[model samples]
Target: MRKITHKKAAAVAMAAALSAALLAGCGSTAATTDSVAESTSTAASESTAAESTEETADESTADEAAAKNCADLIDAIYVQERTADTDARCEAAKAAWDALTDTQKEMVEGENADPEYFGRDTGDASKDDPRNEDEIGENELLVVSFGTSFNDSRVADIKGIEDALQAAYPDWSVRRAFTAQIIINHVQARDGEKIDNMQQALDRAVANGVKNLIVQPTHLMHGAEYDEMCEAVDEYKDKFESVSIAEPLLGEVGSDASVINADKEAVAAAITAEAVKTAGYDDAAAAAADGTAFVFMGHGTSHTAKVSYSQMQTTMQTLGYDNVFIGTVEGEPEDTACEAVIEKVKEAGYTKVVLRPLMVVAGDHANNDMAGSDDDSWLSQFKAAGCFDSVDTQIAGLGEIADIQQLYVDHTKAAMEALNG
Candidate 1:
């Protein structure tokens, strides 16, 4: 049913205006009988139009109320209302899901009808509120990421970064935002954890009268997401007295490879340590000596920035870490695909392999594409190659690493210093 919108309200007002004009016409004198008949006929037509419009307005009011009910039901999927209404909200959400058309369902891109929508209550609704408090200080630090919907990853990776920033800069209140709307929706519907987007986060900073603002992005590199985050900060540059943005986890990509080289070494150290421990080896050297190859799987894109993956591989090799291999899901650099990676490892005479995500969060790509039991998954294809004796995976994101967290803190410090400078 189509809801009565502002357009319908305008139509009702137009009908009322027409009725008043017809009344005034009846009061006017007609020069001829034909003129009088024509005026009378116009009055009848106007009266009919007014009555028809009133009937439509009445019907639309009911439809509008019904539409509101459906919208509320859809909202319940994401919102954690009062404690007492939880059960009723779940039931209403189901009913609303059933009543929605395909178009309405598309509007709800999250898990709206899931039992978990009302199942696991966090017990505090205020925690999920974007604008939890109206109180604001002069300085604000907004942390942004292309977030993960996985609850554990969200807490371990995203929250971990935010907590680090908050501790590092006690004067600046650290708020959170996610670039991925789908992840935001999924998290809200699945765990009732509401997060702000780029615009909303910026708007909140402005509304709170924050003068000095710093945007710290937790992205891995200066990829598409990072570029977009920079654009958003630039778009709202005038909203604050002074606004600055930090370099991503990895610093800028330039002709010189020092920054990315440093990042590659850091990641290599962090993940190699985890993979070694997971393999029951003493250390990275021990694992390397044992002929165990560590594969870092990144979520590659078709963007020109795909060279980052290739650059990582080069950095590793230049650092003399022959045991480390880098590959991507989309095979962006062409040679990083599962088949190509398997061939490389095989040619290198490595019989054991350990896989981990090169991404900030070990979410969907890490869980399914890399390690899942599906026949076409990386682990599966590697196993099918009949070369390696053992294959393992580490399900931790880069954000979970302490050294990586400190790296982000260092970047935040630089950005803040630049702002102060």
Candidate 2:
């Protein structure tokens, strides 16, 4: 079939599967499994098409269903809702979501649009005082987000983080800024969200009579985006006279331990608590017993901080999840990382496998690359190798992480401080 356009690629990949399977017979499922194998959030457009999000009313449980190899081993990742009584469906769903890659979550979050993403409106956000003549006050926070095309989800994911921060520091006034221009226009056109530009957000902060400009980015890591944000902060450095950028959610300076700890805690408290349990399962033991290997797809970066993925994997293993492994789309644990995992499962005599993404959204990669039924996907290759029996998956994403979300809150809190200081 002819290649799809950039805009439609992500939305239609899986939908194309029917056609792909019909024309190619799912052979090896190889041609472009890599096509869907996007491992980074920024590159999600290159990830899988819309993921398969479903809920099978007939399946007894994900475990039972997968035990029966209830699926074809071609493509990867399908976030579906199942009514089966498998341990704790809620927990399972939570685990499924936590397992998404950063890229997956971003693609999903991208669904949010202008005013649709956020609640606040820009009734009159124009900067009457075009110049910054007034003294920048303290007790101010600056929320920096990658910005989204989908207003509603963007409000929840990024702005929600800001709101959390605002709540934490009730004394400080929070001003929002969109690092993306398209998103700003979108807000103005749709929801009347009044953020004009970095200048406007700053003017609003000054108008609020705040000084401290605590800048926090809702980015997954420290890379070009983070760097640009830093630069942006510097550009406005003299204006505030007091500014500091907070650590990114998944950055080198960010507390990986805290992030992962939040992950474990979120899983323990989620609806699927029964399956994963408060006392997480023994990774090596589970791997040995089930003859199953677990692979996590992370939203990795190409920056020097990319090593964080390896560190995260090490941290998970340190948590005694010997069978639990982490890989990224942009950095370490490249595609071949799965080869080692496949080897381990083979050595354990397990013919089947379970693959999940460790992300905030069940977007492109999570659905098509990691779990689609196409031949070239991770699921396809594992099945082809003959050691993978079944792959059970979900798409709950990481939006549920209280601490991760709190990270955003913290940034805003700090930003508020910068504004008011």
Leading candidate by TM-score: 1
What C-alpha lDDT do the candidate models reach, one value each?
0.74, 0.50
Residue 192 lDDT in model 1? 52
Clash totals in order: 0, 81
Model 2: how far residue 369 lies from native, Å:
4.0
How accurate locally is residue 83 in candidate 1, as Cα lDDT from 0 to 100?
41
Which residue ranges in model 2 land beyond 4 Å of their true spot? 1-138, 147-156, 178-209, 250-293, 331-354, 360-362, 371-385, 407-421
lDDT, candidate 2, 1-421, per-residue tens: 2224544664465456545445654555564453334323324534433222222322234534342221111001121112233223323433433443443322222223111122233233332111223343465666666554343344444555666776786765556666665444434333334453565666676676565667767666676767877876677677655777876764453444334444243332331222233224443465446555566666666566565555565555555555555655443535326565567557756654556656544445666677778986667767788646676654334444455676566545454456446
How high is each candidate's TM-score?
Answer: 0.71, 0.51
